[model samples]
Target chain A: MPNIKELEDLTTQVRRDILRMVHKVNSGHPGGSLGCAEFFVSLYQEIMDRNEGFDMDGKGEDLFFLSNGHISPVYYSVLARSGYFSVDELNTFRLIDSRLQGHPTTHEGLPGIRIASGSLGQGMSVAIGAAQAKKLNNDDHLVYSLHGDGELQEGQNWEAIMYASAKKVDNLISAIDLNGQQIDGSTDDVLPMGSIKGKFEAFGWTVIDIEEGNNIEAVLKGMAEAKSLTGKGKPVCVLLHTIMGNGVDFMMHTHAWHGKAPNDEQLEIGLNQNAETLGDY
Target chain B: MKTYTYKEKKDTRSGFGAGLAELGRTNPNVVALCADLIGSLKMNQFIDENPERFFQIGIAEANMMGIAAGLTIGGKIPFTGTFANFSTGRVYDQIRQSIAYSGKNVKICASHAGLTLGEDGATHQILEDIGLMKMLPGMVVINPCDYNQTKAATIAIAEHDGPVYLRFGRPSVPIFTPADQKFEIGKAIQLTEGTDVTIVATGHLVWEALEASKALHEAGISAEVINIHTIKPLDDKAILDSVAKTGCIVTAEEHNHLGGLGESVARVLAQHRPTPQEFVATNDTFGESGTPAQLMDKYGLNSAAIEKAVKKVLKRK
Candidate 1:
């Protein structure tokens, strides 16, 4: 594995990739994607036990399901940077006949994506099922999932949350990007999800908190801690308190950039903020 | 015309369980999931036999659909069993995005479909599952005729690699199909031969169609009885061939006439060959709480209803 400095460089490139991909299409959710850059870098580069190439059946490797699929920019970046597919294909992010859809799907046979997820509130259940399958197969590898804080409002998350804990799905670790912002406004202003950590604990899960979700070291440590908490008769939940837009200066501190693409000048400014670390995808 | 008889009455759900248990013995990769309807879906034997392969997913049907889609990622053939109402309408989006669009090999085995859901009333009965499932691309919609055919279809679907909606009933209709018959996915079975009016039926209405054919024979009308088990990817050749000779058709199902088997048959006939058709289905209304027989009769889904429909179609011809 690469050192922390190398991982940080990968993170910088991922942010650039996210900015450019969305700018090219003039669509996609970049606020959450920028917020999740470090998390994706830490997960694919440091944490996960992956294979040399991607296969639909993630049999031996650690499986990850992106339930909050609007943030496909960062996912595609990390996947390409991690060798799941060619980095050049990231250019075709929402084009016609492009495998890279606005949301991640296996419909076009994208290698790393196990299930289709633009429809929120369904991924947690899918991750739970894959974790259960790992148990059934006697494979001890873990299953991980990431959901937006606003995506939890879909109500299917609660059904899966209740079920995962009740069934002791100890092989899974679910992380929510607690950015406290959504498409409309702040999550509190939108729907006011009362105490996400309290809710997870009440549903019988071991909860971990990362004060700064955008920090690479903090994300790496928090996820490692969550991994250690697994297999103890409860699924682990990581409440990652991240800023909606982490790296770029003008995009931070608001949910206004949640689904809006950066224009040419804004993209140039955003690209300048995060210099080409590992070269642009 | 050849006559048909049954020695016993059996619910189609039992055939599902029987087929599931057989798959448990024969195929190792087959797994089953249910959302708090094990007894009603008749999945006890498979659960009792392969406890590990069977999952009790509580009362969350949407989660059940999502989980079933996920299980297919690891080379597992997942069969989800639940009430038809919960299976289709309750989680249509989950089935649409996860299973259908993703093209997962999951079998959504729905029991207590249509008005024959009986006593559970309109809320529990699902008359639009065939329409809802068949509308999605690559989704195969199958409504087996009898208990024997249902069992065969349940087993055959695990081998086919895509999403399938297998709709069955709660009532113990006649076990008329062969016990050891090969279940074809999109083929229609010709139960009787005639040249007057073709009678195509599925699910609980199949037995009723046979009775209508017998009654039609007595009435001097040569009604051809064709059992259309698969609603989508329908046996258009069988329908067209029968209709070319008969010149008119009657479609019977325990569902609404709006989007049920009749409409699918109508689409095929309208595209390929124009034929006068009468629909033997509910007139787009919710079912009421009553016995299966009472509900079928009240909703006009009985043998008498099919016989009346055949006469109505004969006049159009």
Candidate 2:
């Protein structure tokens, strides 16, 4: 399931493994990990169902949650090119016994981290409590999340988007990365969330906007219409429209590469825009 | 000196809805979140006998502590409930990043907590939730102390394995400890054995350190209660072997002698047995609208302020 020119050569080798793992751990957060490299390479190469051996209680599949964890270099380069761990441990991202942590963590048990976020709006309440524990283990599966529209002015992500729309939770699917920039600048002059899709449709959610979030076929048609608007009870939210530093053209539109790093000649013009595909960690 | 008789008093949030409906009928991965304070955290009998492992979550205590830290990611065991000041200072960084730095077995529980939540003063009284859940890292704080040790520390923090907080209270006091004992989490519970001081205590001040150890065993000054009920890995070898055979210590708690359980048994008796303690608690202030017996006698936290802090730490030994 890989084409858009092999997902733009795996989003340019996940922005050259996020500028060589944040310039060899001189620190991390390369502008929301290169503006969330085509939404984590179109959700781990064409929208998640995932399970090539990465189970930390992912029971019967689909589960993702990186609540804007300072985008650990596009989530450790699409979890080491979608295999979950070693791509030379992405050269130890935030080093010193790194399970790639500068933010995402499960205290190093790290087989696709079940939890431990960079303390933002708590990853849509841990993906609506893992989609309410996959509907109490009957395992209908599906729970994904991501955030950082200036971490949605964090009031605990509006108390987890008003508790996944008053408990309907509908298996879950959340997203934001609206990249209006942050780390101290334009989130509308810092804090103006005015009309974040009218604040998640006034907190009952089901929103969806994706104006080509760096276009991996419009992020797989806005994540396949956010998974057919999840089970149809409620809880959806999309809004993508990224570019915090998308494929690094001079680290795209400001916020000074959100958490800097690109030194060696801006990581060779951010690895010549788009080519390395699946090799280069 | 036995005389302990209360037969009926209840409200340790209905012993956490009768220990979460007996851990949802013997743990089928025992769930239950809450937030909208389901009848003030009594959790309507485990949301009426497990309505598919109950999870109302309306008031959103920081997204019910991140969906009880993502329902411990598929292993379930959540718990949550609310109001010990919105379960520890309104979702303390969503329970310090989705349940204590992601150790996540969840269980926060909490009820009215200190100053007995009477008339909802000091904004639903919390008194520093066992020093903000025992300074986090790995967490397991517990508070219990009545309604048979908060229904045996809510069926022993559902066999423990990580982030717990438990706590309890909200008026109707006296139930007197043993309704079928066996709770344990971090041990402690000595109860009587005396030798001059060592009061110690915990939640609802362990019935004010068993009425200040029955008034220091009727003034002959024996006093040795103990009962910490787990305030984070702090059994410290039963508090340094009961302060090395009771040399001098007092404690008690309805919380707030800064990070309570009397500053974690005075920092484990000042880093191992340098004794002479005292505390009895609540002196750092902040509680109002009386009657949890006049705010446990205006915050001295009753049983004659743990029998005057066990005669002021046995007159500094």
lDDT of 2 at A8: 77
Worst 10 residues of 2 chain B by lDDT: B1-10
Give me the TM-scores of chain B across the candidates: 0.99, 0.36
Q: What is the DockQ of each candidate?
A: 0.79, 0.33
Per-residue error (Å), model 1, residue B82: 1.1
Candidate 1 scores a C-alpha RMSD against the true structure in Å of 1.1
What TM-score is obtained by chain A of candidate 2? 0.35
Clash numbers, per candidate: 0, 0
TM-score of each: 0.98, 0.41
lDDT tens readout by residue for model 2, A1-281: 56688777777788888888888766777887787788888887778888787777788888989888888778877887888878888887787887777888888887788888886777888888888888888898688888888888878788778767877888788888888999888899977878999878888888889897887888898888889988888989888888888777887888887987877777877777656767775
- Predicted structure with the largest DockQ when compared to the true one: 1
Best by TM-score: 1
Tens-place lDDT per residue, model 1, B111-169, is 99988878878899877788888899999999998889999999999889899999998
State the weakest 10-residue window (summed lDDT) of model 1 chain B. Answer: B120-129
Best by lDDT: 1
